[model samples]
Target: MSGIIQLDNSDCSYIKANVSNSHNDAVAFEMKFAKDITIAQLKSKLEILTGGSASTMKVELYKGDTFVTALSNNDAKLGFYVNCDGLRLHVIDTFASFGFDSESVEKFELTNDQYEQRGDSVRNFLKQNRLGKYNDEEMQQMEAKRREHAEQMQKRAESCVLGARCQVTVAGNPTRRGTIMYNGPLEGKTGIFIGVQYDEPLGKNNGSVGGKSYFVCPPNYGGFVSPLSVEVGDFPPENFDLDDEL
Candidate 1:
């Protein structure tokens, strides 16, 4: 019969663990576990901290040399593996080694416009997956900075020349290309509005916008847009056919 060996209170210590993905990106975590902690218990803690499954982790203990033993038995207590304070454990993610096509890991960069396209989804994901280490004040400050940047971008777009080619993305519609005919507040409007002469008749009215006439244009060829929805860039003028021009 095998006898169980009890560890004193002083024997419990914090283990310095590093979990590395296939790309060699590593996150450090301080794990406090007693000598009686099982391999499964340790991997579970690592899973929560690293945002990965414990089943895919390959655990290795650092005692002194590279020949140190690996922790492969889920039922074995940590005491049966090593005996050292400040012991280090390396957890390699086998799931992340399968390449980009696998659902294991995803990496990509987004431009400013690309980010705005899926901003709502990105915000929700960030809020849901944020680490507990970030304080409330820190999160608020981050949000404030993001709002400020967006306001600055809108201001820059509003500074575009009146005759410049532009594009505006309105809710419930795809991006519409046009020319900035006017930029300012209109009667009965409290904020600045951008008057656009669309390439196609994808607009609500002629140059007269918001129940007020700002410029002359064919019917259903002009519209007013919000400065925030506008993007100024080089776009070729639309060749108007004589039939449609009427």
Candidate 2:
């Protein structure tokens, strides 16, 4: 007669088992536990993973789809059971079925109107503190600053003449030499933008953005920048030689 061969406990130090629980049907994970650990110790470690109390957790062993036996003896070593690698350990959390799991608990939520009416809400705090939009003086100052920024950008855009050799100097980026191809407010945008054709493939687009063609250039050789970032000058193209030594 042929039967399943079981290995000695001393042969392997640990067994890799897939863990699942009835609380969360969608979740399953694999863990490796030492064969020398007691069933109670295994359950203690599993509490952190499954959120089930170790004392009340019932662990069942399975070989593929076949049910083996319940690990009812907590004091018995995990190796004392007929388990090995690739086995499944199904944890039955009895308390979880009664809505003990946080996911299963019903949550209370407030509508926008209800939240706005609460005195302890963030909106109320901001309003009471005269912060953000609630401060009329700050709003007026912000509007003035915005208008000043727009005027400065307009001057910069006027300075960037089309077909002029220019260099882009944006913070945190390498200086890029390019020819100014277009300089104006983009379609559906508020601020002015300067379109440039880089000397090399150091750009993000082919002279187009948001389905609108601002200018025409080769692929990966065109980009748009803020008008203030472009400076019209005698910036010449840098020669790139493949055979140059480092």
Candidate 3:
């Protein structure tokens, strides 16, 4: 409603398909479906230009003198909400948006190995194919595929995060260090940290005898990442060469 956020080419520092992970309030901020020129895109370009590890990232959006910090917190009120015009798009996601009157939607959480920063790959592909902007039809197609993939991954990854009687571990240990849960043997070193006691943040003074807690997942594996349902995973580069003209 805020005019599609009017996101432009130079206004972003980085827009990652990820969970905000910060619990300044009860809600987590997720940055996904990044298009346009955003902070992530800029960070990718800087990486390509400078050729180095992504440095300390401090991104902020500006309209005039004020900087936007997603949602505002009422330290006095003790709660937080997603920012207005806040957006997160996922092909494989935890939270599903069933508009109008769909109330059966269920969100799942899991922990896995950290994924690398691929926004540059995405940006490069977009630039190569001249697909920087998203039209309605394309956006719709992407959203649909995201949901589909999310469902499938949910089947695979959810086992390690949620279950009846479960044990979760990360990095080949039974210490339960991540958000993985399993109902059966993996036959390999994967899918741990399921059914662990992940923590949440409460008022500093609101801690019970148990204490406030949250998940300590590795980077890139914390936030939700989308899966592509385009099928035919073996498409050659030539098949996608004209993506710009799409």
Question: lDDT for each of the candidates?
Answer: 0.61, 0.74, 0.28
TM-score of 2: 0.48
Best by TM-score: 2
The TM-score that candidate 3 achieves is 0.23
- RMSD per candidate (Å) reads 25.4, 23.5, 22.9
TM-scores for all candidates: the values are 0.37, 0.48, 0.23
Ranking by TM-score: 2, 1, 3
- Across residues 1-246, which tens digit of lDDT does each residue of candidate 1 receive? 001111223445433232333323322333456657899988887677655578878777642223245789999887666443333566767543334555555657666667646747433344455522123564475346546645764576557679989987764467789899987767744346778888888888898854679877788888886676678888776565788675
| Winner of 2 and 3 under TM-score | 2
Using lDDT as the yardstick, the better of models 2 and 3 is: 2
lDDT of 1: 0.61
For residues 1-246, could you state the per-residue lDDT of candidate 2 as single tens digits?
001113223448787666877765334555679988999999998888787889899998765456667889999888776434555788888644554666777977777789779999756776787754566786576456546655777787899999999999764468899999998766744356789999988888999987999999999999888787889989999887879967
Candidate ordering by lDDT (highest first): 2, 1, 3
lDDT of 2 at 236: 97
Alpha carbon lDDT at 185, candidate 3: 21
